[model samples]
Target chain A: MKKLINDPKNVVDESVAGFGLAHPDIVTVSADPLFVARAQGASQGKVGIVSGGGSGHEPLHAGFVGFGMLSAAVPGPVFTSPTPDPIVAATLASDGGAGVLHIVKNYTGDVLNFETAADLADAEGVRVVSVIVDDDVAVKDSLYTAGRRGVAGTVVVEKVAGAAAERGDDLDAVAAIATRANANTRSMGVALTSGTVPHAGEPSFVLPEDEIEIGIGIHGEPGRERIKLEPADGIVDRLLAPILEDLPFASGDKVLLFVNGMGGTPLVEQYIVYRHAAEVLAEKGIEVARSLVGSFVTSLEMQGVSLTVTRLDDELTELWDAPVETAALRWGR
Target chain B: MKKLINDPKNVVDESVAGFGLAHPDIVTVSADPLFVARAQGASQGKVGIVSGGGSGHEPLHAGFVGFGMLSAAVPGPVFTSPTPDPIVAATLASDGGAGVLHIVKNYTGDVLNFETAADLADAEGVRVVSVIVDDDVAVKDSLYTAGRRGVAGTVVVEKVAGAAAERGDDLDAVAAIATRANANTRSMGVALTSGTVPHAGEPSFVLPEDEIEIGIGIHGEPGRERIKLEPADGIVDRLLAPILEDLPFASGDKVLLFVNGMGGTPLVEQYIVYRHAAEVLAEKGIEVARSLVGSFVTSLEMQGVSLTVTRLDDELTELWDAPVETAALRWGR
Candidate 1:
């Protein structure tokens, strides 16, 4: 594998150390248990927000740790779930007088670990609440998940919930906001190529040169179908059909449209996807109120794209527009 | 090539259209001559900053168009230099009452075309000053360039120069700042795989599975040497040696360290590189006063990275910290 790494075993630690050094003003790294926390620490009276998952999909939990976003992020090994120890440690570190909220993706491993962490934190006198995100509409169950797997919609949940917590919302309020955002969000992905994990030294799956995988999961889970490669618009139609119907997003409903790159795709292509998706939404009389296009959440060097749509009300829109300063996502500050 | 595009001939236009749609609040797209201009147009009295080049290396010229950055951007076909017509159009559109400055990379075609555009704009009564950025320390000259090819250091030039223009500096003053930044900057890149141009339908160059090209140019040009892929630190040592000696960067020199991914590499690996590069600098006693890391400048999904270091004074540091908003780079704002 042609990856710029020293040892596969040290990828997460070294990368985390580099992240801490690059943004010392924004985040602090704890080496003992490997959790990234806000450099300024948790606010005295504001509810703390924390989330985490596998290491390969970067800029997700760790890169989102900063003002107006996550308070702490716990990362596991590449494509593997973190144990409850680090999650509990992160929860404790992020907790303030207002308690803490854990935004967990709906994968079986992630859900179980976060649950155990919440219980452990509660035992230590910290009020903890957990909200599970299951916004991927591609499959009902996959390799690492029981129900629908959480995907790019986790970004929506983190941003909105983090905004609420930053504005001094209580633990319950932040959890409710996160849960609501997860419920209203839908995401679907298509992979043009499989990503090889550093340790595995091989691609997770073999895809022919002329075929594409539709409804693929972030962890290279088998998708709904694999078909011959088609035009960009045709692929968009297939991915968007399920997402729109799953949310049943109706005409006149305003929403935030996000087109994300699956690591290896360029920004130009992501914008092309965004352009056509926006055009399709306009044609269906659905209002594209807000738009985000880039590679925020990615599967280590996979070449593909994911589309996410989040139904937004006035409150949600305002929260989305609020100032945020993170290593990956930043705006309105 | 398996690319996410429609007709290869329509790639630039369609992507530009998508970019305009994605960031309508920040930029305005013109189709006639094809240029991306700031949404609010040129400030009434502030000197305008403009930059452009071939497409594919995205988020470079077009993505940098917004407040406190390029006033206008012109993009050509993929991996091809733009003609003088669009360059002139963008120049005229960005000209305020004060004047306009053109930041051109050192590639031969880009230099000649931008010079012609500047002359045309001068004839139109807009005072224009042009600055060429040639910060790659890779080689004295190579394909597509008469001098050292401009690489990721163009970002340093545009950002510092954009801030100068935004603060109401005259055209000459902005050009001087840009020239200074370019002079102090040095960059080197390494490529593990060649990037495929959409229209080319093949990779730019072929390489065996176990070797990498060090000092590789952004356009897949031949580099200094080809050797078996080594560990990340060893590769970084080789890339940083020439950069340090080219400027003869001395101990105690305060600088800004920028680690830019060349498209296909994952963020984790980029950070791993940054970790080692920063350690090397620290060992040399060069103070890393400011840091900018990410895939700001890219080579169309090539698996590689470029490292850039800019000597910073108090003025440049303040300018770098200035508030700016663009599709790709945004911070203090």
Candidate 2:
């Protein structure tokens, strides 16, 4: 209840407007349907990349729109998926002659809406394609999602796929790279506290002060397991054990490791987790070719951390290293 | 209490080691007298920028080391200023033929230690100058600081001054620009919840559930005022009023507005604060030429936001726009 917002209904409206004003050089906020697109417009002969979900996971969908990243991002309310209108609008706005690709996270609402939007765009001759990301290793089924939930690995897919698209890859090529990344990446998270949904005016869940939730979804959905809080290294091992085994990464494997903070976790702590993660990986003979540690995707003010591992090939590695100019992730630009 | 750290006693040691490992491409961490320096040493004829203080305010002195930011960063233990050895070593390591500039925050320990380091470096035949940042508009005096506490404006001073140094400005020129930036910038902050120091195993301060601390220092020192929790807009107004009045930013004035989160606040909430802040500024006819919103400098996982406004001249604006590559802040590089 100590959240900083007014009316709860206007959080999305005001935040998106504020985001557009702050990064005028990076994005252009559109009217009517409400979507964020590149301020520089579509690149000639380049495929347009579009991705979005609920608004709470910031720097994910919206902040990831700019040169070398997403061409457009359509955000819904805090945790609700956007309707088809905005998705279709974003596709239209970002499309160039090369076509457009829609990156959908694996949640029932998001998947359905984005798929509907892609159909509508393709019918209008936009040549749109959809690639789904289901990288969370936490649960096989959830109250809000079927199969696995899309967690932090979405960031990896966006960066690698965005890099490929920036290199003037065809729509199919971009989608192919994105789908491959989605298949290769796995993420799992632990939450010490639950996030309060703005409109609900209360936390989504509550736990004892000494207990913790392992494998929780970003929205505070129940995880497969809950346990007493442990030390940093032990907790990191718990999160990473399932992920490394799920990916089944072996000796001599080159990988990109992303240690992400759930909104309230500190960077210093994330790095501590990363240090242990690196040690664990080294013991298993897995070499981290590229690594990122920060809060790129987050639940609103949840104190936790998630670990995502993307086994990379030369193509994925080169794409990740390519230039990206976005509000959240920027390099080589 | 819910921090992702190993031993409370080893938080700083492990975290710094982890940071260096994660960013090997950007920095080289030295032992004996620990300091982080650019992986690619000093520029031949350009002045070097060096900074250090307590370790809790992350991405401040350490993450800002690279090509166009600080050449070297010396980190102390959490909430404790580094000793003279590391500071002297950083100054000596970063010093090129053009001399070195130490950007010191106005905290008593930091100022005294950095001054001592400058003296030591000077005796060692390295030309060194120091610029102190006291832009916090909070208390006129506090327990740990004599003047205002140096909060978020340190980021602004580092970026602009680092850019000037990167342009091969002489020692005096770089120090002068840094001084002017420190003088023109003003900041104020409010914390909804206090951050816990690891060793203490408790929050730096405490407030009731419905109460808030206004003008709180980064180290959780007592602020000038405390009041009931308010909405985001009202809170933004409260924080911005003192900063704007102190700066007396006038009509037609161009400024850089930095909305920094104190570790725990989410990006969405920060943008909401920024949205309202822009409205308040436009009402006064001030033009914001540049804006940065993130958790750049933080006090562990404190839930608060700091507002910094830097009045910009043509030279300052150009320097601000110049390409600089660092782990935290990077644009046009």
Candidate 3:
């Protein structure tokens, strides 16, 4: 694997170290039970927002730590769930006496660990809630799969929930917002190339040239099927169709559209896909109230893109428009 | 060959359309002589900032247009220089009564076209100045090269110049800051794999799985040498060494370090390199006043990373820290 890592085993630790130094203005890290917290101290009367998962999908959890985003993010190795230790530590550290909420993607390992951490934190006098994001519609009624795996919608969940928390909402209210955002979103992706997991020193999976795997999972998991390659317009239609139907985003509905590159796709390509996706949505009379197009959530050097749509009401739209300051996504001080 | 594009010939126009829609809060576009301008309109008395170049290196000129960055950006086809007409158009569209400044990278086509446009704009009663950035130290007096090519340092020039203009600096003052930023900065890059231009429909150049090309230019231009793949630490040292000596970044000097991905590199890998670069600088007693690590300037999905270091004085540091909001970069606004 042509990865920029000194040692495959040290990828997560080294990357976290690098991230802490690069964004000192945004985060502070405490190792041992590793977690990254906002540089500013947690507010005493506000709810604490915490999210964590495997490492590779960068600017996802760690890069989202700042005001108006996650208060703390616990990171494990690439494609491996963080054990309960860091999640519990993150919960306690991020707690502002209001409580802590864990935003967990619905991967089997991640769900198990975060659930255990929530239980452990609750037992220790820190009230905790977990919002599981299972927005990927690509799994599509497969009896062999674990429902749907969470994908880019975790970003929207963290963003909207963090905004609500920043606005001094109670823990319950923040948790409610997170749940609503998660429920309203759906995502699907296709991988032109597989991600090379650092430890494996090989791609998580491989596909032949001239074909792509549709309904791919974020961890480089096998998708529902391998399909012949198509143009940007066709690819968007494939990803967007399931998303639109799953969310049932109807005419005149306001929404936020996220076109995310899976690591290796360039911004130009992402924009190209966005062009077709936006046109498709416009044709359906769905107004994209807010749009994000980039590698906000990415597999490690995987060539692919995912489409995420979040149906929005005024409450969600206003919260989405609220100011956020993070290393990756920043606006409106 | 695997890219999210409808047609190779239409990539630029389609991506521009997508960009305009995605960032409507920050930019507005004019169809003819195509240019992206600040959506909120330019301040009447401030210097107008404009930059343009090939399309592939995204978030460069186009993504920088907004309140505290470029007043306008004109983009050409992928890896090809924009002609004089659009540059002239952007210069005119961005001008308030103050004047317009063109930030040109040191590619022959870009410099020639921008110079021609400047002359035309001057003839049309719009005062114009061009600041050429040639910060890459990788060329190293090679006869095969046209001296050093511009790279990531262009981002620094636009940001600092934009801040100066936002502070109501006159055209000369803003141009001077941009010029100084360019002069004080140095960059070098290493590409693990070549980028495929859309129209070309093939890889620009190929490196075997076990090798990397050091000092490669943004458009897949030949570099100083092709070497065996090295660890991230070794790679950072190679790229950062030339940048440090060229700027002669001193023991006690304050500098801003930018670790840029050439499109395809993930944020995690960029951070991994940033970690090593930061450590190397600290060992030399240089204090990194600011750090920007991401794919700010990228070749279309090139698997590479570039290191840029700029010696920062109080003026430059404050200007760098100033609040600015753009589609790609934002802070303190």
Candidate 4:
């Protein structure tokens, strides 16, 4: 695999250290290979929030750690979930005298690892709650299948739950918001080009210049469909039709609209996608209460975009508008 | 150009529309192509904020809009600044009652376009204050040249200024804070592989698998140097030594460290880089007040990372912690 570095074996360790050095004030590296930020008195009854997955997607688990976000973000290998030990360590490090909430995206490996960590944390008497995010609408809930995969909507879940925790809510409240947010949201993505994983050292898959993959997952996983490239308007219809159909969003219902770039897609193109998406929404008589069109969550250098929709009520809207300060997403009261 | 889209022309429009549909609460598209957000009130006062840049980097110019950030984000094509008409339109759409502040990232194309837009706004009797962000350390500053390019540090400037604006700080105060943040910060990036610009339909350039480009601009522009791949620790030194040398930060001075991913590197890798970077900073005796590691601002899907450091004081810290509620970031009391 073609990558920049002195040695492949040390890639994970070095990257974590670099993260601490870069954002020293908001976060600090612990004795364990995880990140912890100085909380606003974690011991003062604030529920700790911890989240982690494979490392390739930057700013997801780690960058989102701060005052109103995750307290600890564990780093695993590229595209690999953090092992049980680091999860346990991170949970321990972020224990603010209150219980800890583990926000695990619904990948099989991530769910399993986080589960193990939660079990271990429970054994240690550290109250731990696990919330699995399964927002992707592309995956069919087959009898044998685990159901839809989690995609970009996890950012929203983290922010809402993080805000709840920051407000000194109990683990139950935070996890409830997280679960509701995950349930209320749906996402679908398409890849115009396959990304090259650094370690794999090759394109995830070779695509002819004109081809595209629809319903893509964040880790360069296979999408639900593949079709020839089309206009922005047509593409938006294809991607959104399923989401709108599945969710049954009604006219005048407020929603959070997210047009996320899959690593490589440019903002200019993202805007174009947004324009067409708005047109589609207008046709449906749906009201867009808030919108985020950019690459908040991403895959590794894959040239494509994902569309996520979250029907928002007053509570979700308030939580969505609540202040947050993380390395990636920041704003609020 | 290996992209995943079915058609090149439809990419941007599709992305933007999809984003609007996803987050209907805090954002929407205006009547104008460039003006983003619902027609309803969003900004705090008449002193509306409008910013734009060539597209590609996510959550920078556009994602930072709503309650506490931007009123409108005028986006141009990938790696190209928005034209004058769009800026003027966005300015008008965002104007509440006070006027407008144009936060311009210091690139030749952006400067020129924003200048033209400011003149147009002036002609319309709308107050327009423009702040140029030039924080890259790659280029040496001398009377003989244009000085440093604006890199990722522009985000800090925008956020601080946006917060100031939200607090009803006059355009002048907001502009001044933005100017100071720009002056206090510096950033430099390196590229491990060239990115593919979708419309251009080609790799920005070819880099041998083992080599990396240092001091890169966000547009995939050539950096100051290209060298063989080195250890993450060594790369940290190579990148940070120059920044530290240039700033000559005093001992015991606090700093905000940012290890930003250039689109493609995974979180695992970013954390590893952080680990090495932290070691380097500790050796320097700098009290790191904050550290951010993630893909905050990105190049289209380049496999690389950039380091941004901002010397912080109490005021900056307070401002950094201020709440915001945009599509990308949200936080506050």
Candidate 5:
């Protein structure tokens, strides 16, 4: 694996340290427990939002930590879930007078660990709410997840829920918003190549040169099927079809069409995917009220694109338009 | 060869269309003689900043065309300079009563074409000032460049100069600031793998499994040397050494250290590099007053990172902190 890293075992800690250093104004790194908390600490009475998972999908949980977004992020080893300790530490660190909300992807390890952490935090007299995001419409179950794996749509959950939390919503309200966002959203990805895990030093999976995996998960899990390489538009159709149908994002519905690049894909290609996806949505009479096109949630250096469609209500749209100051998703602030 | 593009021939146009679609609030795409102009058009009497070059290095040029940045961007074919016609068109589109300033990267085709476009625009009564950015400290001259090839430092120049122009700097004042930014900045990149041009259907260059190209050009041109793959810190040291020496950055100098990812490299690795680079700078007593990380300028899907440091004075620092709302880079609104 040709990666720009030192001792593979140190990837998470070193990368988190670097992230903290680069965005000192936004976050403070807690090395022992390995969680990134808001530099200014949790706001006095606002509900604190915390989300985390494995480290490979960067700019995810960590990059999303800052004002108007995640209050803290606990990144585990690459593609490996964080233990209950860091999650509890992050939970306590982020708990303001109002409480704390945990937005976790639906991976089994992550869900279990965050649940354990939430229980631990609750024992300490903290009111904690946990929302599991399983928006990937690709599969019903995966190797690492009992249900649909949370892919790019986790970003949407974080953004909308983070905005609610930022507005001083109570823990239950924030959790409800997060759960609602997850229910309204759906995402599916296609990978041209698999990302190599640093520690493993080999691609998580291997595919023939001419085939592409449709409905691929973020952690290189098996997708619905592998098909021969097709044109960009065809691939977009395949990825978007499942997401649109799963959400049943019907005509006249307004939605946020997010075309996320899976690590190695360039922004140019992501735009191409966006163009076709938008065209398809337009044909269905779905108004593209908002759009996000970039590499937000990714699978290490995997080369592909994921299409996420989040059905938007007036309140959701307003919250989506709210100010967010995270490293990965910042706007209006 | 695995890229998310349709007809390799239509990559630029389609990608630019996607860009315009994705960022309708920021830019309006002009088709016939293509150029992405500000959605609000050129602000009357304010110096218009326009930059362009080959298409592959995205978010540079087009992505930078928005408020407090370029008024317009002319993109050529992938890795091929845009023709003088589109350059002239973009120059005309961005020209307000004050004038248009072309921040051309120091490339043979780009420089020649922008020069021709400037003269053509001048003939049509648009005042045009051109600033050639040659900040790459890797080599004095290489394959497609006469002198040093402009690399990531072009982003710094466009940003600082764009801020100056946005604040209503005149043609000369904006040009001077751009030139100063270019003069004070230096950059060097290392590529673990070469990016394949869409049409070419082959990698730009090939390296052994355990080797890396130091000071590699954005176009996959040979760098200072190809050495055995080393630890991330050692590689960061190699890339930073020449950048610091070329600028002869002094102890008292305050600089903006930009760690840019070359498409395929994950943000985690880029931060690893940033961490080490910051440490080295601190050791040298140079304070990092500003920081810009992530893939702003990129070689399509090339797995690498580039380090750019621009010596900042009070004026430049203030301008650097100015609001920029581009598709790729946005902060401090």
Candidate 6:
């Protein structure tokens, strides 16, 4: 378990510095201790979007900063939430006078940190709206506990809401879009191999070579059950059945099919999953409007796949079709 | 060595079918021998860009099909070239009556198959042009061979060409743009662990726990040299020095820096590489206009990373910024 790094402690900060240098026009390293928009001059009147959590998921928070996505992304330790100061710094840097929107994934640490940051921003007379993306279908949604944990579907929410903000939509409108994106998207993942958190140089969990854990968390949390590795099509069906049942997608409705890799899976295997995913959808007569596949959101180097289906309407489709220039996504003129 | 696949032979076709079901609006699939396209119809007078290689690079040729990128992708067997007929079918499916442009990555099998299809299309009086992407800096420019081979830089070429074609550029114009994008972009890769090609259920190569290889091909081809795993900053410096020297990037020029994972490398590590890449560029006063860090074009489950830099001009930047709606790249309005 060797890594190519300077110091384990400086990994995130050095990475942010590199990101700033690579896209200086679009971003700048704020002495505020994180990367902020270069156009401190232009953040006014626009509802600033700020999101951050962990450094392992590249292009999630920092790579997402640009025109239509996030205004700033505060860097945290790998798979850990950023401290309150950086979040507050990002909010202040992106406060466009209109307000700021904090999109936090429903991880406990992320939620708590973002909530505190929101409170601090309010104390400073900056209007702050927070939307939590809790789209993972793997966790049970019981009133006794928090709703399903947020997973990769957070990317969908960021894109749609970011578009709403770029279109001059008000803070309320942007928040509404974020809410809708979250409501419409559902995701579930399974880990074939547990990831070794670089600092923790061992497997996250151990499974027999023939077994895979279903309904696993992003950081290789235990899944619902262990099953023999099946064909890709069957694996896709297992993941999607719960998702479709939970969301209750109707016939003739459209969806944005996302086949996301959990770190160690190759594109070849992912395509196999996507293939079966399409078969399942067609059998149900669902119309897929657009499709996305790759490691947009990852859990270190966990060997698995997550399927996120975002039901699309005319508006969502249009927003999804909007052009964005970022390190992770780029399209539309 | 276990995989989530029923049979290796049916992987590509089944995956194509699943993709069609998942993206019906953007693509339509035929059953007899699989081929796909956007149901909205190809853009009129726009050069229909098509590309394909082995089926292992998921979300690549197939996942990239949509509004602005590839119109059709002819998928081959795993790590093998797609048959000639499928290439012809993909061309026919995407030819919008304007003409068609083929974005072929430089490989002997791919070049020959695409050339054959272009000749067949020419016989049918269809205007067809092919641009071979040979941007891998790992290969030396030798008269004895066709110079350096094309690798990850093909993605940048497809993206830029897709933007040009989507803007209603003619075949010649799109082909020219693709050629320039290919020329301006250079990539070099190195693997830590060998990728297990699906059909071959084992590691592609073996390295001890401490050693790493530099200037390796995405496929399991041998690299320029093997060395002990070093600090990320030094690793990136070693990799980028050859690319920068070969391409001769000048001071103050804008470049797109991509630190792509070879499946098994974690983003945390990729970020370390990105951080070092930025510092090295800063030391030379070279500026990166945009940077992408993720697993875009991967080589199975290889524990490696590839660095690609494309010199950007205003036109190239605009084209790069153009909005594309695909299974892989979706952003921009």
lDDT (Cα, tens digit) per residue for candidate 4, span A231-265: 65678788899898887777887788888877666
| Candidate no. 3 TM-score | 0.98
lDDT tens digits, residue span A118-207, model 2: 999999889988888999998998978989999899988988888989888898999999999999999999999988889988899998
User: What local lDDT score does residue B103 receive in model 1, on the 0 to 100 scale?
Assistant: 93
TM-score of each: 0.99, 0.99, 0.98, 0.79, 0.99, 0.87
Candidate 5 A-chain TM-score: 0.99
- The local lDDT score (0 to 100) that residue B27 gets in candidate 2 is 92
Docking class of 1: medium
**What does DockQ give for each predicted structure?**
0.79, 0.79, 0.84, 0.39, 0.80, 0.46
lDDT of 6 by residue, A44-148 (tens): 678889988866766677767877788888877777888888899888888888899999988778888889999998999988999999888877642212667
Winner by DockQ = 3
Model 1, stretches more than 4 Å misplaced? none
Task: Give the residue spans of candidate 2 off by over 4 A.
Answer: none
Error of 4 at B128 (Å): 5.9
Arrange candidates by DockQ, descending.
3, 5, 2, 1, 6, 4
DockQ of 2: 0.79
Query: What are the clashing pairs of model 1?
Result: none
- Candidate 3 stretches greater than 4 Å from native: A140-145, B140-145
True-vs-predicted CA distance for residue A215, candidate 6, Å: 1.4
Model 4 reaches what TM-score against the true structure? Answer: 0.79
**Structure candidate 3, residue pairs in collision:** none
lDDT digits (tens) for residues B134-177 of candidate 5: 99999999999999999999999999999998898899999999
